[model samples]
Target: MRLSVLDRSRVRAGSGHPEALRDTVAFARQAEQLGYHRFWVSEHHGVPGVAGSAPTVLAAAVAAATSRIRVGTGGVMLPNHQPLVVAEQFGVLESLFPGRIDMGLGRSVGFIEAVRKALGHDQEDAADFGRGLAELLGYFTGDRAVRGYPADGLRVPPFVLATGAGARVAAAHGVPLVIGSFRGEDAMIDAITAYRAGFRPSTWAEEPYVVISSTVAVADTAEDAWRLLVPEAWAMAHSRTRGDFPPLSAPDDVLAQPMTSRERGLFEQSLRGHVHGTPSEVAKALDHLVHRTAADEVLVTTSTYDRAAMLDSYRLLAGLYL
Candidate 1:
């Protein structure tokens, strides 16, 4: 099956305070026309580089602006939040958008040690990610017996964001599992096998659902797509391999920007795992993505320096689908 696009609502270059919100609304509207399935925002805090720190607030806006595309987190980092609060927030979203709302959960500070400590957590709080998962679900499923409350039986459905041990948690709880496609395909096979083998049906989820997110860039030409992808590609590679986000130059200006050999290595290896190329190339990658994850759905994590180029990329990919 063709892959489904999941917009990251990435902040545009030189974006103002409201730019991310405006881009999100516009992106959602345009994606509706392009035939994408769902548009998910990410979560980050104290990071000037990211704008999706409050995905729930933004998800409400996206839901109101678009009619068809499902809206939710690509993965909400649970370590920094309260489970009951998340449950209530998404619960209300579910009430408003109905079946169009998805609650993909995650287990990370999504920031860093300094930032996480500032946010009021110790290094050991990550151990409670499993507890946070249960609490968030209890709030959604009206499982008062478990520890959640937004007033009575009001509940929303939930999904798990599986990365490392999160895969096992998803399996144990029988929630939908979304492996971070930013990583690689090896863990995907391992996680999916684990989730299916260990799944236990829940009130919200029956069969095991696998929704892996991929950072995809499609354009009219391979070179053009690669050009549009440099900023995001550079940022992700720097974060994982080097512990920071590197400086990103303009698409037209990247030739002058210099990167170290190590930086290039990370950038290249990370790029190899993602879907980047023309529509035809992306289509082939997506086909392989489907078979590898055995995912019920594929969520395309799109990015660019600005919203126009990002929007163009998504539109082009949508055309490839039909």
Candidate 2:
């Protein structure tokens, strides 16, 4: 299976945004050297633990830093952006990076009400996500009234970030679908099956393409890999209970703290959903995931408090998967 990298630009508890972003760019270079297919960054608004608020801007930096790997947003939230603006921003990136840029779009709105208002979007705007996607795609095809400048003729392969109804939308557009593996194997199989069955031919794609993103970590032993996932698991549990996604903490500190029954349950559930183990173990799980979902590519999204360990994890996975 083809392997890709998805760096969320996660900030550790003690580190700042600048360091997080620098790590993202550096990680992109490392991923390229490791023979990964593509390196994508994400977009998150008003999240303290995430430094990737503007994926296009970060993608520009990544493209400038790397010469081989394709760089783009893991996605740009469509509900939070104007279609023309997104088209133009990615158009500019495509102008520079040419065939090496992706335009991954999503249907999500801001995580909070205030953040939605800041972006001048409401919950109702999410209903227009399909329309926004159509508009953005139109710009590239020269069908829209307003041109996307350099993007009019350029082929910026658009991929939808699939979740729930997103699979249907992707099928309708005939674009590639990018889904997360945290939703369980059964759900993933159903979504990909439905997408392929309903796909319609378009200039962008003639067949179904699925990219599965999974939280993965690899180490010398199964126990060590699980230890590396603690910080992110704890952060997810904290977010569910506290309504905020805090920066990752040291695994030792996380394991030392006492948790409420609810937090403990959430933490364990989060841990269960991820793929973490020794290289052979991770490879087995990933191979199963690929066969089950018929995935065209697998993107690994792993974050830990220790940068060296995190890099090592990627290297280990690349050695096996790539």
Candidate 3:
């Protein structure tokens, strides 16, 4: 029944970044008021629809606005940033918020071509993601470097978000791991098993903490939830068919488009992997996943069309959990 915020940061094409930041802060504040456990921003670059490219800054802003809810990244791509800089930023965050910050690192940038270019990188430029991951952990844990940084003091606790059976990294470091694979329970469990086997107890953790982050929405009625979820489903469909940087489709638009070829494939893939429905429905899915995976917590992602809908989604979803 645990719940946290997963902001898709649904900014439209003409939406201003300042406005998005303001809206995001407001959303975080509301999440805290509603008693959500955390507000985790995502790292996306060169995506017009998502403005959370700098999760550290956004996380700090959210932390400053709210007193209790945890604030951190659903992920910061280690391949895209310097380990030292990430260490200092999250260290500052930990200093400011103390025990209320969580750092989730990922191996992939949240977008494709434009995102790569924005980060001044290319497919060929990708760091050995595993190596970069180790380096980032080193900066925080006082292990990788022989000199100042990896040997210095930083109090940030970092987790790895493993989407495709890579949770072993989390185990090796003895930090928490978040896995949100659609329904690849077998794969997810396998990774968790690997992670637990590889874990080395650390200052931040003696045992494993695994959280499941999945798509979620809730409404007064099943039909209503379906209606609200269409925006998010369509938003994702919009991304795969048109590419991953466009704003969401209008409900009517998604309804109008006949599922075909690539779009159909994408929709089926997402449905097989994601959790989407009314509070009761989502709760059912949640319970099923928890029963199957024994996840310690759940992170709910709101990727709907508008800010209001997203807020309402969490309000209802969390209410169901309560």
lDDT of 3 by residue, 1-322 (tens): 6778778566653566666777888899998889898888888787767777788898998999999888899888877887777777887888788889888888775377765777876644343667666676676667754433422566666778884445766776678888875657787777777777787887778888888877776776766666666666666766877876566555576677788777776665554456666666778887898888788889888665656666787888778775
Ranking the candidates on lDDT from highest down gives 2, 3, 1
Question: Model 2 — which ten-residue stretch has the worst lDDT?
Answer: 145-154
User: Per-prediction RMSD in angstroms?
Assistant: 2.5, 1.0, 2.8
How many residue-pair clashes does candidate 3 contain? Answer: 1
Candidate 1 lDDT by residue in tens digits, 42-136: 77776655666788888899899999987888677787788777877877887778778888777777467788878887546677888888777
Measured by lDDT, the strongest candidate is 2
Candidate 2 residue-wise lDDT, 1-322, digit = tens: 7999899999998889999999999999999999999999998899889899999999999999999999988899998888999998999999998889999888888878888889899878887888999999999999998888877887999999977688989999999999998888888888888998999889999899999999999999998899999999999999889988889999999989999999999999888889999999999999988888879999889988988899899999999967
Candidate 2: residue pairs that collide: none
Error of 1 at 197 (Å): 1.3
Against the true structure, what is each candidate's TM-score?
Answer: 0.89, 0.98, 0.88
Model 1 misplacement above 4 A: 145-155, 237-248
Tell me the deviation in Å of residue 158 in model 1: 1.3
Model 3 weakest 10-residue run by lDDT: 144-153
